[model samples]
Target: MDGRSLWRGAVAAGITLALGIGNASASFLVPQTALPGKNVPKYRDPLPTFAGSRVPATSGYTVSFEEFKQQVLPASGGFGPTTVWGYKINGNGPLWPGYTVEATKGSPATATYVNNLAGPGGTPPLLQKYLTVDQTIHWADPFKLRCMFTPMAAGCFDPYTGPVPAVAHLHGGEDKSDFDGGPEQWFTPNGMRGPAYRTYTSAGAPPAPANGAVYNYPNGQEATTLWFHDHALGTTRLNVYGGLAAFYFLRDDRDTGRADNPIRLPAGDQETEILIQDRQFDTAGQLLFPDGFPSGLNGAPPNPTVHPFWIPEFFGDVIVVNGKSWPYQNVEPRRYRLRLLNGSNARFYNLAFIDGVLRSAPIWQIGTDGGLLDAPVPIVYPGRLLLAPGERADVIVDFTPFAGKTVTLTNNAKAPFPSGMAADPQTTAQIMQFRVGTTVTGDTDGTCDPAASKKSGNKCVLRTTPMVKLATAKGTTAPGVTVATRRQLVLREIEGGGGPLEVLLNNTKWSGIMESTMGTTNTPVAGSTQLVDYWLTELPTLGSTEVWEIINTTGDAHPIHLHLVQFQIMNRQPYQANKYLSDWMAALTAAGKGPGDGPPNPYATVLTDTLSIGGQNQVIGGNLLVTPYLQGSPVPAAPNEQGWKDTVVMMPGEVTRIAVRFSPQGNPIGGSVGYSFDATDGPGYVWHCHILDHEDNEMMRPYIPVKP
Candidate 1:
């Protein structure tokens, strides 16, 4: 066979890395098969931010999501060019890392998102024929797919692979309920929309443009790191994997780039962002993703004959940064602020820097998924900072001492997280390299003075105004009013036929009944609530405070994420895994009740919206038995993580408690104690595991904050 056909066969066989047998760059190092995306003009600039306002200078530009051709993978790395879909501005190439949108606090912005992707709508998605899309499992079925069996089994729907659906969700923004971009609000390019979909009708907003959903973002919260990406139900994994995620920065007067700004962080070229993700490539030089696992490590589909494309987790063999695989960056000798976002589908990252001489750099963390920390935390090299999916780390790397040397940013985090497989050297181990230039930038030249800030003595001091602590608002401790309520919820994963079927919150599907204050008006449209559905339980009073203890009983760590409001992480405490789970499961099976019957331990401190649940260790036996093997002491939020946050890691075998305040409280940071609009109106919100695969299959639930 010819070289092209041979490579195609190799990809079909899942040969992850391209071979460098014939060429010799380094003895064992694999060679590049294609040119780097960075080499293309206009590919490396800080993505143009869409400030969708009328401020002529900063008003955002309208963009559309379309299927276009761009060189995703390099041709030199034993791979050719790749055709991928992405958001394009001014009809440009759908840039791989996508685009960024900036919003200022209090200055609202509006944009109409248009979906122009091509066909597969009548039949199955084109991707399904190339990759995997298990139609048997519960998923978005705009075409009403069904199996072709003579005797159709109960609860079986044939896989419907068709035209793609698209929607944009601002991950950590406090916006009106309708603009929240919940899964059920998906829309196709032809204007076919999900049941819960709504247009941007925030009071006096302008009419939506033809054939698109208009989104109005009220950037009324504090300045922090938020991201925008496709959040369509069921197809989120495929859409994101197809390349549609980017950063969204909410700025304020305090975070101004001027040298006189009180909180001087890095700005201009000195401030950089690295979006780290993983992917697999086919031999034909296209993106390769499987729909199922042959060994069934991911349990069989709930209905084997129908949904065949779903899998438990997806781990890619190639690491991508800013749209290039194993690319390099040239850095001058100075302190540079770096924002690291773990955008992988399911892989976690433990990142650190190593030089050619094996020496590591002094790293300091300044921010997180939400925003900047009060004080800088020294990140000792080799003690790599761990970042789970959907998490962010705002850090500074001082490269003055390592001038003229090549330093490599490395990853040691295991896949599937905490207890999963260790990283393979050729793929996940090494992320990217930095070539430090010998020419030194002036010592105190940058906007942020790292040397002075290091000695500020208040490195541990939080400078933001003091907002009401969850404890104070909940009345559980001194100096606060009584709490509005307290609730204990459980996160569970259900197994079918010994193979994993799906995950659920409170052991209930999305279609499960939720006590809606709106009465029958909240009902989902007929037929839309099928195998995969969500329940709007945990409805909190609009202006009250409540503490929720999330008990995770599964073996895998889940990054629990909540929508609309930002919460604080109270604390995590160890519990008798087998004991707590046994009683909990009994109650769930017998009475459909939660912690009221049996619950895990409770520990209570800080606030966050996303927290990672620690995965428990299990041994192979008649049934999966949880052993306290990997359950160590409870892990608390780091000092740098104590501030306001949207996402935090929840350890397994531990009960993670969080205090959530529905109304805003004016504190030192800058906002007031209430929402600018009626938060309880419209389609409502949801909470789910941020891992794309788990979220797509199950592991998610809807929640409505009630009116007091």
Candidate 2:
């Protein structure tokens, strides 16, 4: 990658900015998932495992999701690979409650994490956990992401902060808006104890960070992997950088039937999950900031402090697996089904295993955040497997021949990122480890034939749906439906005179509570909140098709997504990309837009649901057609997202258009509707941008169902 392209692709995300950020209020701008394995052993998981390998050594408290708080440091670390601060890390305990990481098939999971981070200029003992998601102002996701706890540039600390107010969300999960983790649920360390933390339109309030009490997940969707992150009002970038992220694998015990019923995979551990992420550290082993920061984006006001902490999109220097940086896993020489996730904040990875190349690329793709693919598609070559921030890929790899030999599963994606930050050898050139085994044992873990899979080709058949799947398991969209409703969702951003800083779904501030209208125009009322209705009413129940438009009103490119199912990327139009580096020159550079003049080089992307939408420009375009594999759904069933997903991305300047199915997973549209309804709490489903920061800052709305 050339220096120029490197800089172009990769730029700093969360700097304070110099031109306008000086006095800019970087308020809440944010958005923010479990498993089981079979073995004859029936291995039981204990509490410490959930703390992660290093849980015992670090922090020291084995708190549940409710007891953790974001941290604030008096000093900052200098530039290097970006650093991370875990969101709900716990200290040790003899047998603490809910501190253990438990993975199982066909079971429900819940979390009650909290944050006690102090606002800028806060002192120690700032932690305040125990907040639950059930109590929030017109909110959906009650969990919060603690940004105030995030570390700033080298040696910088904003002791006097407005609030560490947080709202967390699992980017993609087949849950409803409630469990989907939206910003409306934001709260301060104090639940009702804090200001304006409940969901009421008339509630006047000051800023406050929600404690661990605000956030929760009802992992009831499919058995796909999901992630968690901060979703504060305006400080999303800062919060996530402060180290609030992790993975949750929802295990499916029931079979979804993708594996070959009569065939066989060449075999080893029936299935595997691969975790990948990047980080930056300062010279003092802290996270690094790109050059020309303090001011987040171009011509923006500079932050009062000058440390270079990482931004919202975190594609770190080293690869992280499980939780260790560049850690290698010893494998036995057999075909292993591997699930991969690009857990980088901003970086995109094009993955390829360096074994004897792939034969038809093997049946690599199996399941996604929601559920397993209908069937495995043979990989032809290593093209782009784009991973947006907070996105994931559940895939597989065969190590049949490379068993005794060490094969490197490496990444060739350039760093500083192509659209975000530049990469250095120290940061970009590092390799993610996937070491082959030195030994192999048949029937593995000391067992002979422990219930061999009935299917061939695939290791594990998805026995059941993931929790997120259950979240949206209600109804189906009547097929062949036309346009009953058409609403326009635009992603917009403002600079110069001081508008919202980072991403925005539509044009709304992160509603600490409810407002005149929370979501968009066509939203429906559910329980006591508003929801986004992504259905085209005029279309038919089985083969309905409608035109949906997603307007990108921002200057930078963004990747827009639709939950519930996958669509075909129709086309894209180009606009200018944000030029942060060139704009820094004393004189305006060629590509640099003077203040308010739009951006340069904006281009449209015809996507397949997994492409990056370039940020900012005059305009851009993208489209998709929702085609349900199965027919008929009730309660707005988008079963495809059930493997897991609540929101997706619609890149900057692009109006992503597509048709979506409300229901259609298990049975026909009529058969599924209102069959298994849960009105007590809800499976109130929704969809939004995967770029959580944008969603939290009122970029997200809601999706509700008005049953027949």
Clashes of each: 58, 235
What lDDT tens digits, residue by residue, belong to model 1 across residues 320-389? 7766767677878877777788887888888889997779996788766666665677778758888877
TM-score of 1: 0.79
Q: Which candidate should be chosen as best, given lDDT against the real structure?
A: 1
Q: Residue by residue across 1-708, what tens digits does model 2's lDDT show?
A: 532233223223322232233422122111000000010011011101232332321111222222232111112211123223354445432111112233343343344445555534342122211111111112232232222222222212222223345655555544444444444445554442222233211123212223543223334444555555665433454455454555555544343112332223222244444555554332233333232233222222222221112123334444444444444456676555565655554555655566434322233555555556544434435553545555566665666657666555555564423444443434343344445675656553321111234464334433333221222223221233333333333454533123333343333333312122333232221112322312211111332222344555454445455533333222333223233222222222353423212222211322333221121111222111112111232123222233433333445534444444344334332244321223223324334454433443334433344443
TM-score of each: 0.79, 0.57
Over 4 Å off in model 1, which ranges?
1-60, 90-93, 119-128, 144-159, 202-206, 258-262, 293-306, 441-444, 450-468, 471-482, 513-534, 592-635, 665-672
What value of lDDT does candidate 1 attain over all alpha carbons? 0.61
